[model samples]
Target: MTDHADLLELAVEVAREAAALVTERRRAGVEVADTKTSPTDVVTEVDHAAEELIRDRLLAARPDDGIVGEEGDDTPSTSGVTWVVDPIDGTVNFLYGIPQYAISIAAKEGDEVVAGVVLDVTKGEAFTATRGGGAHLDGRPVRVRDVVPLEHRLVITGFSYQRETRVKQAAAIARLLGRVRDVRRLGSAALDLCYVACGRADAYVEEGLNEWDLAAGGLVVEEAGGRWAQRPGVGGKRLVLASPAGGFDDFVAAVEGCGFTAS
Candidate 1:
């Protein structure tokens, strides 16, 4: 059996190492080498470099483990463990020198994520969790906020890079705006989820995110006493809704009431 605690420790270590590399490269200056999906979606040489470093370290520590990174091909594993990684979760923000980007890494057994970590590179904060082990920030235990009423809760969300999808997303946000205390759009999904996990925010909703984007942060939120659900969205996309226990039902209802569907 895999030791989830050990896996969590490895995740935090690898994530911090990757974050260091990303931070160093950003400080030294690197160019945006290419775009993916749309012009608004971008990749930098540092992204690739950081991913390579992460892959190397992971494989070095556990040669039998598989890896699925945002910037590279998947490597199969025979040990029943797969590492899901996003070397730079907010590439656009990284390119623009914004401080909100992060390095996200998660360890999965089958379909369940057993351990995860999200390192806010600029802020030097590490959010981590293990299956059933609760969540932590910089070595201190953290839990979701206990806000009860949905309307009083602060919510965070993100936009899709595709213009058409973003248009619809904006509309949905507009409908939800009046129901919540306020809404924020942080460029990084991983960070947004961590914010919900650590009581920085009450909830988060976003559509069109890949597994790598949610694998780590989702686990953190759940372990921090939060509820998260991925719902079906327009064009076969996935929408993620996460909130504290008190407002979970109302939040989900409000999301669907605003014309969003949960899977």
Candidate 2:
């Protein structure tokens, strides 16, 4: 039997180690390693270094498990388990010396994510979850906040690096602002989901999130007694959505009405 807790433990361990390396490197200064999708969509030397560190540690721990990382090529699994890694989600924030980036890691058996961790590089906060186990922050159990009314729900989101997508997202946000309590654009998707998981926010929705970006944090949100979903949206990208269960259906309706998912 695949032990989900075992996977979660390994993910948390590797993620913390990678976070340390990232923090150490950021202190030395940052250099742009490359860009993806758009010029503003950057990858840094620290990003590559951290990802390699994570991949190496994870593979050393579980030799037969596959790896899918933001900064490296995919490694197929013989053990039926794959690790999804985002070496530094919110790399732009990291480059700007903002304290919101994270090391995200998740383990999946087949297509189902079984375990996950999102370690905040700057805050030293660890958000973790397993398939049946509940979500936790710093080892204490956590849950999403009770239902907030539509006009008072604090919605969080991210914009695409591409200008066209950002333009559309802005339009959606403009429409959404009047209906919700407020909105925040926090560069990191992983942390945004975790924020909702721990009741720091009431909901999160974003389009164009890659699998590595969503895997660990999405699992955390689900395990926290919250709800999430994804569907085709503008540019054919997946419009990821999440909220406390009480507000999810209404939040989705609001998101759609505001053109968040309009093609």
Please provide, for model 1 over 1-263, each residue's C-alpha lDDT reduced to its tens digit, 9 standing for 90 to 100.
89998988888888888888988888899798888889978999999999999999999999999999999999999999999999999898999898899999999998899999999999999999999988999989999998768788899988878898887778788999989899998899999999999999999999888999999999999999998988897435899999997789889899888865633
Q: State TM-scores per candidate.
A: 0.97, 0.98
Which candidate's TM-score is highest?
2
Worst 10 residues of 1 by lDDT: 254-263
lDDT tens readout by residue for model 2, 1-263: 67999998888888889999999999999999999999999999999999899999999989999999989999999999999999999999999999999999999999999999999999999999999899999999999999989999999999888898889889999999999999998899999999999999999999999999999999999999999999777756889999998889999999999998865
**How far is 146's C-alpha from truth in model 1 (Å)?**
0.7
Which candidate achieves the best lDDT against the true structure? 2
